[model samples]
Target chain A: MLYIKIADLKIRIENKYNYVRALCKDYIIDECEDYDISVSVSDKEIDDEISVAEVAVSRGYAEGVCVYRNICYQLPVKFNSYLLHSALIEYEGKGYAFAAKSGTGKSTHIAIWQRVFGDKVRIINGDKPIVRYLDGEFIAYGTPWCGKEGFAVNDSVPLRALCFIERSPTNSIERIPASDAVLRVFQQILTPRDAATLDALFPLLDKTLMQVPCYLLKCNMDDEAATVAYNGMNNDN
Target chain B: MKIKSGFVVREVAGQTIVVALGEATKIFNGMIRLNETGRIIWDMLSVGSEKADIVRRITEEYDIDEKTVQADVDAFINTLQGANILE
Candidate 1:
């Protein structure tokens, strides 16, 4: 069982499948041992718990045989697609993360910004970063969950804005009220089931919204939408 | 219970957490795991329209047998009732 803390929330990631550390169950619980992690092998199989334990490497991703509880899941020893289930990223940065339903082109719009702003911006987390409040300041951290580009960089930065993505004919970026922004981001966030941990999430979100601005970035997969999003974020008051 | 737009719905510890354009407050009790189809049913019910109107929409949209739809709808309604998240 591994204890992980974000904001004030405490979660335990227990590798219970086997020796390879291939299967993990993240629970929002103060007590770690009570949570259960189990898996039944499907087409892909790795001998036993020992193999699962061996696979739990310190700092890199791997393709392996694994399961998410009762559901049999496979992870490419090397994952390149959008980090879907296990990737968790968070940080404290100058800007908030952009979150949306899958296939919403969160990566594409981000590319537009990189092309337009170039040196003015930094790539904090490509996808599914964790955002939390530590002490009194919010922080974001990069997790194993790197989206399409498979760009995983473990770093933290100060958040400023959160942008929701959508492709629209007219390039427009509009501010979303703090209440709405918090809810949207919260939905996209990967949370476990600990009341204390869950409770911390909303408060941090509220705090982040109080200081940072959130917006809906609607535009074609063109630079104009990126421009509108940036301008809107900078202008958020 | 209350419903709102774009609420990120999550199942946490068998509890339903709704982040409805506000906070990630939750409604817990008997759980309803809204699958793709279930979510569609929930979306329809969320419109605040009459149950009969929702039934009409479901009949038009899904290929489900009417009896099955009614049963599913009733089961869903009972689940929500237990959770107190439904009107």
Candidate 2:
């Protein structure tokens, strides 16, 4: 059994298999007894998730089920949070989230910001980050299941802006209405497949949108694009 | 027919929007924005009211004639049906 602390919750992982333990190597901790939630992974458990037992015979499925069981499925519902598909970055101590469809160049755009600001910007999480409402404000938190790039930190910052990014020949930034922002954000977040979780997700999402400002960013992968987006977002606030 | 189970109507920033819930979200894709009258008619649908019931309630709620309310209700139902949101 391994105890990992993320998003202010102590999660206990009772994995009988070595794959999940190795996958969570960076997150392993010692000397923690009380746990907020406990998840277990085994060959039988994976077989139960899929109808064909043959399909569950792999290390990848074992590791994925563990994270999916804990981070993507259970934690969000329990904590009133959403796992947004975006590249989160911290700038000036405030978190900015850049979101788009897969291969829409969210990482490329954030790279431009890093090129321009050079060390002034830090990626909070490259792929999925938890956006939760706490202390009357919305915050972006990092988790162990940072997407393909493996870029995630065990930290959180106050959410400042959410930009729905799209690839364009020319760069432009437009402030969108809250209603439009809510719909766009709903698509970007990892929505649950059940009714109970969906009910919790809606009000939490609405409250987050009410507190944070949203924008639509159209830009190319150029240094000037970052400058334009940065200036437009900063000047407006 | 009845309105889908997972749809929730909400008012945000003075705009009335209908969001799809759970599995319904996969088919709807995005949210549906409704006007004041549309919101009223949608509320009636939520309670399993029929087309005639919607027309009557809409006519009573607004100053419009029954014929106009019927046409509006037909158009709204058509829109919902086209989106495949009605159960």
Candidate 3:
């Protein structure tokens, strides 16, 4: 059993493969008998993940995927946390998340930020980050399941805004109303398969949407895109 | 017409979102976002309301003309029907 801490929850994972352990090394903690939650995947679950995976995956990778999926599935009801499919970054001490459909250049946009802000910008989680509502603030935490870039840190940041990226020839961004943001945000979250968990998620999701500002960023791959995104979110525009 | 079973409706951020779950996933795997009027129509449909009855209810509730209400109701119902969410 490997004990790890993620999104401030202490969890015990019954891992069968070294790959999962190494993937989660940054979040590993000293052995402890007490944990907030425990997870273990059956062979069937690993097989299920492999079958649905976009590419071929080894048993170890599939095991890791199943464990993370199980953790995400439990987080909404167990803790006020859920997995968000976004590239989370910290700029000027506040977390900002760039979300879009797969192959939508979320990582590319954030990379532009890195070039513009230099060391002031840091990737919290390049792909999948856990968003937890803590004490009236929505926080973004890094996990091992970050995308192919392997950019992640064992840290958390208070999220300031979430931006949905869209490709366009012109660079523009605007603060979107909750009515417009909800469905876009919902599509990026790992929505629960059961009604009860989803019921618990709706309120948290609502609160997050109401409290945190959301933006629709229609931008091209230019240095100006990062500056425009930053200025718009900061109300400097 | 009625919404398919296993579809859960929730009001989030003052917007209505219908998500398919369990058996409903076998047909629809994504969520449907509805505006205020669409929500009203959806609620009526959940209870197996008829098309003419839904048109009447919306016209009465919103003080809208019957023709406009009928058109909106028809469009909304057509969308649901195309999505296979209405039975």
Over the stretch B18-81, how does candidate 3's per-residue lDDT look in tens digits? 8888888878888888877888888889999889998998899899999999998998898888
lDDT of 1: 0.51
The deviation in Å at residue A115 for candidate 3 is 1.2
Give the alpha carbon lDDT tens digit for every residue of A1-237 in model 3.
899999999989999998889999999998888798899999999988899999999999999988998899899898998999999999888999999999989999999999988988999899999999988789999998999999999999999998999999999999999888988998898866888788888888898998889999999999999999999999832
lDDT of 1 by residue, A39-149 (tens): 334433334433565445422122222332211111111111111221222222365577777777777767777787675555656765556454666556554345558
Docking quality tier of candidate 2? acceptable
Query: Which residue pairs of candidate 3 clash?
Result: none
What C-alpha lDDT values do all the predictions have?
Answer: 0.51, 0.78, 0.91
- For all candidates, state DockQ relative to the true structure: 0.07, 0.30, 0.70
Model 2, B73: alpha-carbon shift in Å?
Answer: 4.0
The local lDDT score (0 to 100) that residue A209 gets in candidate 1 is 69
- Candidate 2, clashing residue pairs? none
TM-score of each: 0.51, 0.79, 0.92
Candidate 1: which stretches are off by over 4 Å?
A: A1-93, B1-87
- Which candidate, 1 or 2, would have the higher TM-score against the true structure? 2
**Candidate 2 wrong stretches, greater than 4 Å:** A40-66, A73-77, A192-199, B4-34, B56-72, B82-87
Rank by DockQ, descending? 3, 2, 1
Poorest lDDT segment (10 consecutive residues) of candidate 3 chain A = A187-196
Of 1 and 2, the candidate ahead on DockQ is: 2
